[model samples]
Target: MTASDARRPVQLEIAVQDAAGARIAFEAGADRVELCQALAETGGLTPSAGAVEAVLAVAGRAERLAVLVRPRPGGYVYDADEIAVVAADVREVVRRGAGAVVVGALDAAGGIDTEALSRWIDAAAGAEVVFHRAIDTLSAPVDAIDQLVALGIRRVLTSGGATRSIDGLGTVEALVRGSAGRVQIMPGGGVRVEDVPAFVSSGADAVHLSARRSSGDTAPSGPGGGASGFDVTDGAIVAAARAALDEATSGS
Candidate 1:
């Protein structure tokens, strides 16, 4: 067979949070993992030394670990202090050997701050860049895509700026076409085991989601527990997502 036939497609990366979660996903066959803290908060950034170290220990097996680089969950725009924090964060994460960096910045009208983003991408020093769902906040996603392309971002994680990807298929498809090999379009948000097919059918270059199971039908004890908007990820969910990926790849 030709070398091209042996080569796989770009990547099938899954967003994940912890070392245990990463191990489960890697074992279940996820190609890569995005390390973050408050996945409930749309997968906010975590630059903790211990967490980064934990993730790095598994870097040998994981396809990659792209750490989310936001200082807060409120918005993409950042004050001077937050920017400094993110700057320092880039240095530390790269020093810790993260495989990629997921981040973004936007103006009040929701347009991407190409300058701010470019600065971070440079600060990241050649590590892959995944513009997070902040793309969802933009008033005109197409415009944002064009802007990001000019900035030379690696990929964008978005659900077509909607509540979930299924609701934004048309726009997502348009984005995939608009990207036209310039960058990757990774769909995310509200993606579950059963809904993965819908994302595949929509022409996503790749998919992203939080996959996990509850301890029980019973809820958690309180706010510090499951009541939080972003529940922690689980190995079972990662396995299911892998199964879905296998089905999608095999055309089942």
Candidate 2:
């Protein structure tokens, strides 16, 4: 960051929906926490106003908290009812004083829904707006960049529409370049400490991950239908992510 990059050390935000998870991201040195209810479902809107307040009350300044604003989980394209629901969710989330709101919408053709996005952005007037990974789902990555830039999104959290960020290097690289300085191109999903450099090299301002590998005692508490493949984000994973950023900074 050079101590003057505006946002230093390449912010490492973690996804934590519960208090226990909040503590993990906070103690492990995550810069921001994207609060949600169903982490396994790629997260939805914040569970409650009280939930957002609780996290802010105890989380550190480095640990900013944000709430997701999806009415329900499905494809990026939302029906009119879902859009209204998400708009309402945005207003509520902002009133609760979240650091940011993560939301996205796609057209029927899998492109950025500028109209729906504007509604979400308008409802979240004071909050930072993150165009969630729905961007990766777009039919055209380059075109999506233009749409997001035109919409003045605060950040675009994408994995290049691939299962993981690393796998979409080429698309991600193009996005970073096309975006230039219009919006922050944040490569997330399956982002690991080891691959942090590539993302940075691809010009990402930040990275996202659950940052947990094992659930430990929380193992039985799974979030999937099969009851297996639980997503476990832990302190160690966050620590490793931090280390990766350090290495990248040192240019090692």
Candidate with top lDDT is 2
Residue-wise lDDT of candidate 2 within 1-252, one digit each (tens)?
A: 333332345678888777678888778878888888777764555577777777777574412877777777678788989889989988887786776888888888766788998998889876788888887766687777777777778888888878888999888888878988788888888777788878766767788887756444434534543453455568998988888876775655
182-243 in candidate 1: lDDT tens per residue? Answer: 88888887777776666665556677876755434454558666452334557677778777
TM-score list, all predictions: 0.85, 0.87
Clashes in model 1: which pairs?
40-230
Question: Per model, how many backbone clashes are there?
Answer: 1, 3
Q: Relative to the unseen true structure, what is the Cα RMSD of model 1? A: 4.0
- What residue runs in model 1 are displaced by over 4 Å at the alpha carbon? 1-11, 41-43, 61-63, 215-232
Please give the distance, in angstroms, between residue 29's alpha carbon in candidate 1 and its true position after superposition: 1.4
Cα error, candidate 2, residue 49 (Å): 2.5
Candidate 2, residue 235: how far the Cα is off, in Å: 0.4
Please give the lDDT score at residue 63 for candidate 2: 26
